[model samples]
Target: MRIAIIPARGGSKRIPRKNIKDFCGKPIIAYPIEAALNSGVVDKVIVSTDDEEIASIARQYGAETPFVRSSRLADDYTGTVAVIRDAILQLQQIGWTLTECACIYATTPLLNSERIAEAYQLLFDSHADFIFTCARFSFPIQRALLKTDQGGVIPFDPPSVPKRSQDLPPTFHDAGQLYWAAVETWMDPAKHIYSADSRMLLLPERLVQDIDTQEDWEHAELLYKVMQSLGQ
Candidate 1:
């Protein structure tokens, strides 16, 4: 069996009640829940959250909250892997024979069923420990600068200062959307998602945004609206 676990803790400090906050027309978490269900790749869609309201909203969007997330794993310090691991263990305790798992973020309003399905296919074909979404840096990271205490600017990578942007290798960052992994891999705590064995599905910058603050939330809503207008 395949499952998608969405970790949506309610203690969002930057953006209050971010997990179930309205986005576009529905709760932000609704997007991923709908995407996972619509994808048809996973056998179940589970929302691992500590908030009752979050659980209620998730169920309304076709996701099941089989178990309430622990307060230990709901804090800001808890990492994604630990939350996913806990959910998997809980499912196992409830007699679920999970073969594969995907961790889909609740705040990803731009996520679609196509990308979720594509990532699952890639994970199956690559036989890798994990698959996640990422996007290329709009500017050359190698030429980045740092501000000194005196307000003076300095090159972060001095050696790359003289190199042309085209000559430098490209760099990518986590799009903070979804991660696909086999059940066995997810159960192993030592198996980090950033390992070399993990594969990444690249997405365009316009389709990726991390909604951590109010500004980010506004930006994502606008971006999502534009994409919808274009029928993307």
Candidate 2:
């Protein structure tokens, strides 16, 4: 069995009610729910949230709200692993067997079924502990700079100041979309998603955005609109 668990707690301090907020005419969380259901990989999609409104909206979007997350797990300090593990355990107790799991974030409005399927394929074929999406940095990070208290700039990596951008190594960042892992690996808190044993599915930087503030939300909406126009 395979499942997709989306952690959408109600206490969104940055963009208030961000998970269910409108994005391109629909609730932001609806994107991931629809993507997971359309992926053809997950047997079930579950929305693990602590808020009644979020749970109600999740069901309306076609995901199951089998459980309302505990206040302890819904707090800001609770980590993703803990939330996923708790959901898996709850499912097991209720007699739902799971072989694989995907943690799909509610903020990923640009998520598509193709990427989710690709990650699942890679996880199955390579037999890795975990897989997730990432985006390469548009600029080489080696020749970075830092602003001083006096507004003066200094080379973050002084040694790479003279090196050409093409000669520098490429770096990437978490796209903040989804993560695929075996149920066993997810159950083990010691198994981390960022370990060397895990793999990453690279996405174009334009298609990746993290909605943590009003500016970010506006930027993501703009990107989403442009992509829709381009028939992406």
Candidate 3:
């Protein structure tokens, strides 16, 4: 069975209670829970959180909290992979048989069921260890600029300064919204998520937002409003 696991730990520093924070009239975590439940590709939806409040909110949105996440895995130093792996193990311990899984972030309010379903299908068709969302950079990274200590602008790649924008190859970054992986792939510690064995599902830049601060939260709200206005 394929399941969607959402890890939402408490003690958020940049944005307190960010997982359950109101976004467009609903909790931010509700989006992923709903998307996973509606995706049809997933057989189950689970939310692994250390806080009871988050678990309650997740249950309210039709997701199961089979176990409360431990403090060790909930720390800031712990990476997303660790949380996902832990969730899988806990679920298995509880007699749940999972074949494949998707790690959907708790704060991705812009995520939709269509995208989740598409990624789930790609995981099967491509037979990749991991399939995650990604978006192209707005500008070429070859001509990236950097500010020196003396407040002077300098090209990151000085040799590529003269190259035309069209000549540079396109680059993409992880959208941080969702990731699908086989059960064993997620269990293996040596399996790098960004390696060649993994495939990326491209998403439009308009739907990607990495919110880490107050300003970022505000910008995301504005973007969400605009997207909603256009019926996206």
Candidate 4:
């Protein structure tokens, strides 16, 4: 069965209660929950969180909270993979064997139902182990610089001849918005949300903001407003 698991822990140091914080007049976690529910790709939408408020909000938004996340996995140092693993285990104990799962992020307000469905379809059609959103780098990363011993800048790619930004090949970076993968691949210790054979689904920079800090949250809000105005 297809499932969507959203990991939201309570101990956010960067932005307190970040998962449930207000975003565009709605709880931040609500966006992903709503998207997953409306996506039509998954049979179940679950939110794995340790915070009572977050769980309650998730439930209110039609997401299942089969169990509260463990304290160990709720800590700041805990990785999201662990949380997803725990959630999958919990669901299994309750007689649900998920065939595939999407580890969606609660902070990604720009995630829409259509995008979620498109990513799932891509995974299915391409026989991919996993798929995640990414945005292209506007600037040439080949021309990146590093600090020298004398505080001078040096080209990171010294082997490549110095070229103008317009002449460099394009590069991309993980948007960190969300990820989808086969359950078996994602649960393996060696693999992760993005598997070895994972595919990168290109997304526009405006829709790929990952809200990890106050600055990021503000920037996302601005982008959201602009997108709304443009009827995107």
TM-score of each: 0.98, 0.96, 0.96, 0.93
lDDT of 2 by residue, 1-232 (tens): 9999999999999889999999989999999999999999988999999999999999998999888899999888999989999999999999998999999999998888989999999999988999999999998888789999999999999999899888898898889899999999998868999999999999998889888989999999999999889988
lDDT of 4 at 200: 87
Alpha carbon deviation, residue 216, candidate 3 (Å)? 1.6
State the lDDT at 104 in candidate 4: 91
lDDT (tens digit, per residue) of candidate 1 on 150-204: 9999999999999989999999999999999999998887888998999999999
The best candidate by lDDT is 1
If the candidates were sorted by their lDDT against the true structure, best first, what order would they fall in? 1, 2, 3, 4
Q: Model 1, stretches more than 4 Å misplaced?
A: none
Flag regions of model 2 displaced more than 4 Å.
none
User: Could you tell me the TM-score of candidate 4?
Assistant: 0.93
Write down the lDDT that model 1 would get. Answer: 0.94
What digit string (tens of lDDT, one per residue) describes model 3 on residues 110-160? 889999999989999999889999999999898899999999999999988
Error of 2 at 17 (Å): 0.9
Model 3's alpha-carbon lDDT is 0.92
Q: Write the per-residue lDDT of candidate 4 for residues 42-116, one digit (tens) a residue.
A: 888999988898999999989999898888888868887788889989999999978989989999889888999
For model 2, the local distance difference test gives 0.93
Candidate 2 or 4, higher lDDT?
2
